[model samples]
Target: MEKLVEQVWDYTKHAKFYSYRPNYAPKTIDMLITLVGGKNLKVADIGAGTGNLSIMLLERNCNVVSVEPNDAMREIGIERTKGQSIEWVRATGIDSTLENSYFDWVTFGSSFNVMDRNEALNEAHRLLKKGGYFSCMWNHRDLNDPMQKIAEDTIIEFVPKYTRGTRREDQRPIIEARKDLFDNIVYIEEDFYFHQSIENYINAWRSVKNPYWDLETKEGNELFEKISQKIIERLPKEFDIKYTTRCWSAKKYK
Candidate 1:
């Protein structure tokens, strides 16, 4: 776990590119908030990278505590979310150091995969008041789309055995396994389209944590350049990428 935490520091170099990544679906976010009893609730957003999800929660009128461990990412998050009803904290999902039984909800937006799952769930349970919800979500590219299929082929051409890791996996089992702490699990997935300039779309790849290639290395840079060139040649100046925000949530139990 310590090593995993250390490895996340690598995001320092890629922090700036995070802004190019697609955001979770707003409609799905509203659904999650409604399921947990509507807005104006207190939320702890773990691994709140660059304040993406935190900003969404804030816009929905939730008071948020944005907890992120990486300095570079956290700094960007702080800057992007300045003047909002948010408190930025330096912390990890396994041991957030947040108040016990204080928050109405604890969420991990595109971040639950980076931590020890069971430990993170325990921490979330500890931070939530009775009946509060624990939720985690990721915005996944819809590979079935034509453009996305092209991108997927390009990635496979570079790294044949590429896998998206736990972020793309069904999270119900993990949360359900901890029945002693949580129950009434629900899963929601909503598809949405994101429009971006071709340049930013290519740059968004830089923020991905690909274990197959280290973006800092020469080989990694070469792979990135090749993929970017392919996209530049194949894609239009501005286009939409299909995305699906998949979310899992459960009520905390005693």
Candidate 2:
């Protein structure tokens, strides 16, 4: 997972990674908005890759601080957010450069899986004011969807053994971890629907530094390319891709 995280910073500087990778859905935006009960909520987005989630919060009229460890990714986010009112910090979640009990909401979107889960959650608890919410949201793809199925299967078939099972985006552990730190635990699941051409889909997959590409053997590289080609063949020019955006929210307790 750490290797993947490092590669992501390198890959995301490319146009493909910076522009084509999936963004959070408006439903995700709505959930956070309502969770904090306002548009101008103070937010700290931890492990905020390229400010994807932070940008969303800013658009909803929230004051946002984006904390990221990767300098390249942080730069992309900074450039994308030129003229916007967001503070970009070069720090990780475990030690975000922010005062304690300073924010109303601390958010992690598609980022918690990369964090030291316990430390990140504890940091969030400390940074958020009493009753302030800590929210973590992730876009989990439905592999059953046609185009998505092909992509997932191909990646699974070719992904390097080292990267396998490194990070599972399960919400349970984080939820349970928060239980002892915060009161009033809650979970919400929302769906986002989209239609994409196979070209777009392929572009999206290749945009991220694929673990399949990290396979160190010639056989692995060959296998990955073969699977990529097969994906292009099997997927339709246009197909529906559904993602479930699962969010867990909890309020800091005294």
Candidate 3:
């Protein structure tokens, strides 16, 4: 196993932590489906956390190959996609162990940042046919919303080192500099509205992440509670937030 995969898979293995995550809007998935433009196409969804994106592709009648490294997370994904016909493989993005020049589409749903980004791109390029599409997408909180701003501020205050807004932005230059790895690169972002309860929202934050996972620790527990209470006291019973789902895609040129 690679160092990055081993480190992330071991530290973040809890499935319940992801139960409250906000789902990508149907329109977002629809756009991806339209891009690929065919039924029963082979799609590899790496970092398929809890099978969110895989489930969508399966519904569209695509043959989805879900590859995830964490057992707990993959187990939950298996459970979520039950009764559906799909392939599950335990693998990381940079080295999925899948054969080359076969799949019609390769996707990373929110896990691209955790991967060796350039290597993953190389692998995705290898796995796809010449005309195959590669897409990476994840939802971002629209912090321009005052409620979201409050949430981010509280998160940063407790975790001081948190880079909620800057993590993806920090990686932009890498994507820009590596255009040689893929061709006709383009980015598309769409804003979608979502509604969730405060309790569910906080629990979604409790995922098995480093420093933030061990809520049993004095420091961890305090930080977790502080953010939770602030959200409850501040937000309404049924609050809405805007989520921007961003997708980056390119083609495997001949």
lDDT on C-alpha atoms for all candidate structures? 0.89, 0.73, 0.78
Task: Give lDDT: candidate 1, residue 150.
Answer: 86
- Model 1 Cα lDDT, one tens digit per residue, 12-88: 88899999998899999889988999559999999998999999999999999999989999999999999989999
Arranged by TM-score, best first: 1, 3, 2
Worst 10 residues of 3 by lDDT: 164-173
TM-score of 1: 0.96
- TM per candidate comes to 0.96, 0.84, 0.90
Can you list the residue pairs that collide in candidate 3?
A: none
- For residues 1-254, could you state the per-residue lDDT of candidate 2 as single tens digits? 23334443443433425455567678767866886785578899997777778888888888989987777778888898888889999777777869999999999876776657788889998899888998887776776766676777766665535242323456666567568787677778777777777777666655444444633458756765687798888777788788777777888877
Give the range of the ten consecutive residues with the poorest summed lDDT in model 1. Answer: 1-10
lDDT score of model 3?
0.78
Query: Which candidate leads the pack in lDDT?
Result: 1
> Each candidate: how many clashes?
0, 0, 0
Q: Which stretches of candidate 3 lie over 4 Å from their true place?
A: 9-13, 165-167, 170-173, 208-216
| Candidate closest to the true structure, highest TM-score | 1
